[model samples]
Target chain A: MREQFDIPEGVIYLDGNSLGAPPKHVAERVQEVVKHQWGNRLIRSWSEGWWEAPQRIGDRIGRLIGAAPGQVVVGDSTSVNVYKALMGAVKGTERTEIVCDESTFPTDGYIAQSVGELTGLKVRAARPSSLDLTEDTAVVLLNHVDYRTGALHDMKALTEQAHDVGTQVVWDLCHSAGVYPTQLDEIGVDYAVGCTYKFLNGGPGSPAFIYVPKHKQATFENPLSGWNGHRAPFAMEASYEPDPGIARARVGTPDILSMLALDAALDVWDGVDMKAHWARGMTLTSLFRSYIEQMTSLEVITPNTLPRGHQISVRCENPAGVMAELIARGVIGDHRPPDILRFGIAPLYIGEQEVKRAAEILAEIVN
Target chain B: MREQFDIPEGVIYLDGNSLGAPPKHVAERVQEVVKHQWGNRLIRSWSEGWWEAPQRIGDRIGRLIGAAPGQVVVGDSTSVNVYKALMGAVKGTERTEIVCDESTFPTDGYIAQSVGELTGLKVRAARPSSLDLTEDTAVVLLNHVDYRTGALHDMKALTEQAHDVGTQVVWDLCHSAGVYPTQLDEIGVDYAVGCTYKFLNGGPGSPAFIYVPKHKQATFENPLSGWNGHRAPFAMEASYEPDPGIARARVGTPDILSMLALDAALDVWDGVDMKAHWARGMTLTSLFRSYIEQMTSLEVITPNTLPRGHQISVRCENPAGVMAELIARGVIGDHRPPDILRFGIAPLYIGEQEVKRAAEILAEIVN
Candidate 1:
C-alpha cells in the first residue's frame, strides 16, 4: 500500500471483515465537522453540504459497485437498509414468496423474516448450493460472500436466473463490495445493501449504504420514510412525500461525524485497482492454506477451486477455542459458531510476510 | 459566560433548536476515539467498550430525564426511534388503532401513517386539545412540546388519560426532555423518544435517545429487529431471537463516534438540575417575549401562560427575509414559512444577559 493506515502493529489483525482499521485522515475531517461546520457555521452547515451527504457518499460508493449516481444512498445500518430494499421488492410484486439461503448471515434472513411477518408475506430459506429461483418467488435475498466460509456467490448468474423467473433480487453485498469490482449494474441488481465497518473501513458501527438501480428508483418506495426523504424537508409539512431520487431511501438525519469518517476512509480507495487488490489478497491466503491444511486437523471450509473472496476459513473441532487462542497468541481473526475460524486477508494492510508468520503461529498451535 | 467557545466572536447563536453547538471538549473526545479506541484497538474496541456506549451514555442522559438506569438507549435518529417506539407500542396492543396528534412533529405523524399503511392499521389524527380518548385506541403519541408553537403538553395528565382509555402512550420528548426534568415514570410514559442535538448540545445530527419503560420491555419487540437486537448476535443462528430488556430496541450497529460525542456532551450536564435548567430557559424566553412584544410588529406566537419549552417564535410579514437579514447581522434563529422567526433559548449556554441583548437587537430591526 502507498499510504499507511492507523491499523495496529505487533498483531496479525484479520478482523477488518468485522471492523476495518481507522483511516489516518479521519481525525482531521471529524475536527472540521466539530469545529468549523457545527460549532461556527451551525444551522448553515445543513445548507453548506450536510443535507447532501447521504447521496454524495452514496455516489462515491456507487462508482466502486457499478451503481449510477442518484441510485444509491449511504445511511442507516446494513440490516435496516436490507429491510427497506426487501420491502420495496415485496410491495412491488404480486407474489409473496421471498427466498434466501439458510446458511447466509442470520440477520439478513431474520430481517427478511421480520419484513414478511410484519407485511404478511412468506419467507423461505434454502441451502446456498441449491437455491434455485422458483416461479412463486417474488423476491430473492442473498449474501454475496458467506461470513463464515468466505464463499463468493455467482451474483450475475443468480440475478439473471431470478429475473428470468420473474423475481427481483436484493443482494447483501456486505462482504463483496469493498474487496472486489462488483459488476452490480452489469448483473442487473435491483436493490443492494452493505456495511462500511468492513473493508470500506468507515469505523466500527459506521453507517452503511444501499443501492437501488436507477430504473427502479422512481417506482420503489421503501416505507420507513422520514422527513429527510421528504420532497421539501424544511417545509415542516405533515404528509410523507418522498423525494424523487435515491435520497428517498434516507430514513432519518445522517450521522454527520460517522459520515465524515466514512468519507475520509474512501479517500484511501481513490485510485486503487480492484483486480490487483483481490489477487494480492487471494495470493496471501493461498500461501497460508498450503502451510496449514495438512499440518492440523482443521478442514478448510472455503472452496479451493471456486472464486472465493480474499478471506479463507478452516473448519475445526472447536473453532471458537482456536480463535480465542489465536487472539491470545496475537493473531486476530474471528470465530463463527461450531467450527469455523475466518481469517480475513486484507491486502490493503496485511502483506505476504505477515501471512507467512501467522501461518507458522497457527501451525504451532495446532501441533 | 466566561469560557469562550470555539464559535465565531461576533455570532449571536439562537438556532440551537435545529442543531446544537459542539461542546468544547468534543474535539478531544473525537480524537481519542478515532486515534486510540478505533485506530489502536481496531475490532477489539467492540469487546473493549464500544458496544456498551449506547447504554452507558444513555444512563448519563437518564439522570437528566429522571429515568431509571435501564430505561434509556442512544442510537439512530429521533425519527427512526419514533418508529421503533410506535411499533413496540402496537405490538403490545392487539387492537390496532393508533391515535396521535396531527400537531406533533411531522415525523411522529409520518410514522403513525407509515405503520398504518405498511402494517394495515387504522391511524387516527386525534384533535389533541379535545382530550377525547376513544375506546379502540391502541396508542397515543404526543410531542411534549409543539415544535412550532413551543406549547408544552401536560405529560402526566395526558398519559393518565390514555391509560384510562386502555391505550399505551408514547412521548416525543424531542423538545422537552433535555430542557426540563422529564420524569417519564412520573408521567407514566410507556415509551419515549428524543433528540440530543438541541438542548443537550450533542452537536449537529447527533444520535438520539429512546426510552422503553422496563415494565413494558417484555410485552413488545422493536419493529426494526436487526441482529444487534439478537440475544446472541455472534452465534450466527438462523432464528430471530431478541435480546432481553431494553437492548431489544437496538436494531443495528450503533454510531459509536456520534454516541461518544453525545457522551462528552452529557459530561457537561452532569451537575445540572433539569428543573433549574428549564426555569432558566423559560425565564430568558420570557425576557425576549416581554421585549419583542413592546416594539414594532412582533407578535409572540407561543402562549406565555402555558408551560412552554426552550423556543419562542414571533410573527412578521416577511419572516424569512428578516431571518436572512438577522443571520447577516450575526443573530442566529430560523424562520418558518409565511411568518415566524423562532428564537430558541438554550439554557446550557444561554442566560438572561444574552436573551436581553438579543431582544434589544431584534427590537432595533423591527423599529
Candidate 2:
C-alpha cells in the first residue's frame, strides 16, 4: 500500500491531513479522462460517464465510510457541503439554535454562522462534551477529528445525546474519513460532510461528499438547488424540482476532471482492511509521540489515552521557525498558527519508518 | 487557432457552446499539476501557486471580459456562482422581486427561484423585452446570449434600463464570455457570473468565475460565506468576517486541477485579439446559417439580422433522429428537444470549413 502513492523522494511528508499526496495512478487516470473521455468523446461523455460520476464516486466513498448505497453523493467543497448539510438538517424544524463548538475547523464554524445568519437561527458555540442540547437546538455540528489537536469525538455518544434532545446531528469528517472507518448509518447521524483532499488522497481541492440517511433523502431540501439536481436535468425546465434521494444534494455541474482523479485515488482502498489501517495509524502516531517525548522538550497536545484520529500535534515556542527548519531538512509537516506543529500519519502511504524519520528530524530541529 | 485544439479526426464538433473541445495543452498541464505539483509538492503547493489560482485565472478571464484586474475571482460551479451573485445583489435591498426571463438557462432560473425562496422575494419570469422592472425589482438576472435561440441581448441598454428603475443587474455570460468581447465594466453591470467550460475551452465542469465591480466589492455579501472568503483564512477564527475585495467571492478551496486546466485553456487567448475572435465567430456563424438555409429545408431559428453569440439553432422535424444520424456521419452537434438542432461556432478552434462541413452533413441527414 505504501507503493500506491507518489510521495516525493527525500521528503518525509506528514501533511497528509492538509493535502494528501497524490496516488501513483492519478496521473494516468487524469490523462485518460482529459484526453480520451473529454477530448475524444466531447459532449457525449456526459451521458456515458460524466453524468453519474458524483453518485458513482459517492458510492465508493460511502463504502469506505460504512454508509449504505444511495446515501452519499460527492460534489462541491467541504464548506459548501457543510452549508447544505446544516441547512438540510435545520429545515422544517421549529428549533432555532445551531449547536457547534469553537474547536471545529474554521470553515465549518463559518458555514454554521453563515447558515444561522441566512436562516435567522442562533449559532451557539459550546465545548464538545458540554453541548447543552435543548428543545431549541435544531442541529448539532461536530467534527469527528479535531483539525488542530487530532482529538476524536465519540460520534455515537454525541449523536445519541443530541437525539435525546430532539436535535439532528451533522458531522464534519474531514480529518477522519478514509483515515479510519466510520459507521455513520449505524450511528444514525442525520447528515455528514467530508473532504477527499486530505486522508482520502484525492488530489488537491477534489470535490467533497455528503451523507444523508435513506429516510431523510426524499425530503432533504438543499438550499443551493441548481438544475443538475433536477429529476430530469436534461429536460431544461424553468422550475426547480429536486431529484429524489441523495442526488438532490448535488448543486451544480460535477467537476469531472477532479472527480475522476478522486475516483482513481479511491482505487487504493478497494480491498483495504480499514480496521487494520486505523490500528496501524494509531501505532504510528503513538510511536511518534513517544519518540518526540523522549528526544525533545516539546509537549504533545493530542490526548494519549483518548480516541484519536491519525494525526498528532505538539506545542513548541516558535512553530513557524521549527516547521521551516523541518521542511528544509526534508521532513514536511505543518504548523497551525501560533505554536502548534501538526504531523499527520497516513497509514496507506506513511509507515513506522517515515514516522520515526520525521520524529528524529523534529527532535533535532526543536533541540 | 484551430490547430491549437485536439479535436478528434473526422468530427466537425459544432457543440463548443455545449462543452468546448479540450485544448491540446490541457492534458500536459493537468499531468504536470497532478504528478509534479500535487504529487511531489503536496501541501506546499497551496502556498506555491494553488492559493491564488482562483483570482489569478480569474484576472486572465477578467481581461477577456473587460473587467478590472481585481474585480473577478473564479471558484465554484456556475450554478453556485449564480447563487452567490444573485444573493450578493439582492441582499439589503428593499425591493422584493427578482426579474428574469423564460429564455435564461434552466439553472439560472432555478437558482433565481432558490434565491427567492431563501430570501422571501418574488421571482418574476417574463420576456426580456418586457421585464417590467420597477423600483420593486431588487435584482434583474439576464443572459447576455439566449441559450436556445442564440439571440444576443443588448447588455448596455438593458443594464441602463434596470439602473434607471433602481434595480441591480446580474448578467449570465455563459454563452457570451469567450465567444465575443464583453465590456462588463463599461456596461456598468453590478454582477456577472459565467462558466469557463463552453467557449473558453476549459475542461468539463471547470470552476466558474464571478465579477463584482470595484465599488460594489465592499458591500457585496455572498450568502455562502465560507472560510476561504475570510480576511485571514489560516487564523482559524470562529466568526465569519469576509475578506475585502473580490476574493470574498471565493467560497472554498478551489478545484486546482480544473483551475489549472482552465488556466492552460485560457493561454490560447493570450495576446490574441478579442475583436478579431468575435469577427471570425460572426463570419463562421454567418456562413453556417447561409449554408444551412441554402442546402436544407430546415428553418434557421437563430436570427440573422439580430446580434448573436457563437451558436446557431435550426428547427427541423425529428431533430433527435437527425442529430443521431448527423453524429454517426461525424458532424457532431446537439439537439434540444421539441425540435432544435444547435450548432456552435467557436472561432478559437472552429473555422468556416468545419461549419460548412457540418451544414452539409445536416442537409444530408435532414433531407
- Which predicted model would earn the best DockQ? 2
Off by over 4 Å in 2: none
Candidate 2 per-residue C-alpha lDDT over B131-245 given as tens digits, one digit per residue, 9 for 90 to 100: 8899999999999999888999999999999999999999999999887789998989999999999999899999998999999988989788888899999887778888888
Model 2 lDDT per residue over A184-252, tens place: 998899999999999998889999999999998888998999988999998888798999878999988
Residue A145 CA error for candidate 2 (Å)? 0.4
Find the 10 residues in a row with the least total lDDT in model 1 chain B. B1-10
Which one is best on lDDT? 2
Model 1 C-alpha lDDT per residue in residues A1-367, reported as the tens digit of each score: 6256876667888888888877778888888888888888989998899889899999989888878778889998898898899988888467868898777888898788888887777888986667777788988898999888888988888888888988898998888877878888888899999998898889878899999887888888867878888888878788888888888899888888888889888888888887777777778878778867756657787878657777879877777777778888989988888777888888888887878888888888887
Q: List the residue pairs that clash in candidate 1.
A: none
lDDT per model vs. reference:
0.83, 0.90
What value does DockQ give for candidate 2?
Answer: 0.85
Q: What's each prediction's TM-score?
A: 0.97, 0.99
Worst 10 residues of 2 chain B by lDDT: B358-367
Candidate 1 regions off by >4 Å? A294-297, B1-5, B92-96
